[model samples]
Target: MALILVVEDDRLVRRLVREVLRAAGHNVRTAVDGRRGLRLLASATFDLLLTDVLMPGCDGLEVIQQAHRLRPGMPIIAMSGGGQWLKPDKCLNLSNRLGADRTLIKPVSPQRLLDEIRDLLGA
Candidate 1:
């Protein structure tokens, strides 16, 4: 099992992801926003970071950029529901440019989430 950091601003989604990761036998930690996520990253070691694309403070793209600087080779899975502008693809492409290992759409199935994580980590 891996140590996964879930960074999402939505409380319900964050809890749901926490539950899913826990059910998959992975250790899970959560941050409500990118700033907090960065703080957590500075203080602890994690196998992966699963973060939402859009957030109230320090968006996921910025988080990815900063995290990459702080921890090169750290795997990141960027998630989005394509809020407002319906630009999921654009967000995903940006994530790719920022060096995320993978991108996942919101409302993803638990199995798919686990599969993507495993694939990215080569587990």
Candidate 2:
């Protein structure tokens, strides 16, 4: 199993992801916001990062940047439900531009999410 950090502000979403990954046999850690996510990235090692794009205190784009800096080879999957101002497609495209290896629009299916992670990890 791989160690994955899941950064999401929405409580339900975060819990859902954590449970899904755990059920799939991945060791999962979570952050409520991007700042904490970055801190975790700095302190520990992660095989993959799965993050939501819109968050308070630091968005997923900045998290992706810092995570890349901390571990250049780590694969990142950016997700977004979109806000009133920005659409999900735009958020995902921006995430891609900022170096996220993959982007997913919410509500992401558990199977699809697992597939993405497996593909990235080649597991």
Candidate 3:
């Protein structure tokens, strides 16, 4: 099982993801926003980061940039609900540019999420 960090501003989403990852046998850690996510990244080691694309504080792209700088090849999976104003494609493209290993739209199935994570991490 991989150690997964889940970063999301929405409380419900965060809880769901944490529960899913834990149930999948992953060691899970969570942060409510990008800033806290970055702090966690600095303090602990995780096999992957699963973060929402848009957040209240620092965005997922910025978090990806910072995390990449800290851990050059760390894997990241960025997700987005598109937030009314933003497009999913735009978020996916930006996440790709920022070095996310993969991107997923919100409301993704738990099995699919686990599959993507495994595929990216090659586990």
Candidate 4:
């Protein structure tokens, strides 16, 4: 299994992702926002990064940019649930343009998430 880092501001979403990854036998680390996510990246090594695009501060795009700058080959999966201010595709597309290795729409299924992780890590 891979060591995965999950970054999301939504507590419920973050916990759900962490638990899902754990159940799949991956060692999982989580951060509440991109800032904390980056800090975790600096302090530890992870096989994959799964992050939500929309956040209160230092959003996922910044995380993607920094993650690539720090580790160009690091695999990243960017996710988003669109809101009144932005559409899901808009943010997710930008994430791809920036550096995300993958983009998943919000409400991602456990199986799908696991599939992506496996595909990325060759698990």
Q: Give the whole-model CA lDDT for all candidates, comma-separated.
A: 0.92, 0.96, 0.91, 0.92
TM-score of candidate 4 versus the correct structure, residues matched by position: 0.97
Error of 2 at 113 (Å): 0.3
Question: Highest lDDT among the candidates is held by which one?
Answer: 2
Give the deviation of candidate 3 from the true structure as CA RMSD.
Answer: 0.8
TM-score of each: 0.96, 0.99, 0.96, 0.97
**Model 3 Cα lDDT, one tens digit per residue, 17-42:** 89988898899999999999999999
How far is 80's C-alpha from truth in model 2 (Å)?
A: 0.3
**lDDT by residue (tens digit), candidate 4, 1-123:** 788989999999999999998998999999999999999999988899998999988999999999998777989999999768999999999999998999999999999999998999887
Determine which window of 10 residues in candidate 4 has minimal summed lDDT: 65-74
> Which window of 10 residues has the lowest lDDT sum in candidate 3?
80-89
In candidate 3, position 78 carries an lDDT of 95
Tens digits of per-residue lDDT for model 1, 3-100: 99999999999999999999889999999999999999988989999999899869999999989888788899999988787588888888999898
lDDT of 2 by residue, 24-75 (tens): 9999999999999999999999999999999988999999989989999999
Question: Cα deviation in Å at residue 74, candidate 3?
Answer: 0.8
Query: Against the true structure, what is every candidate's RMSD?
Result: 0.9, 0.5, 0.8, 0.7
Sorting all predicted structures by TM-score, with the top scorer first, yields 2, 4, 3, 1
- For model 2, which pairs clash? none
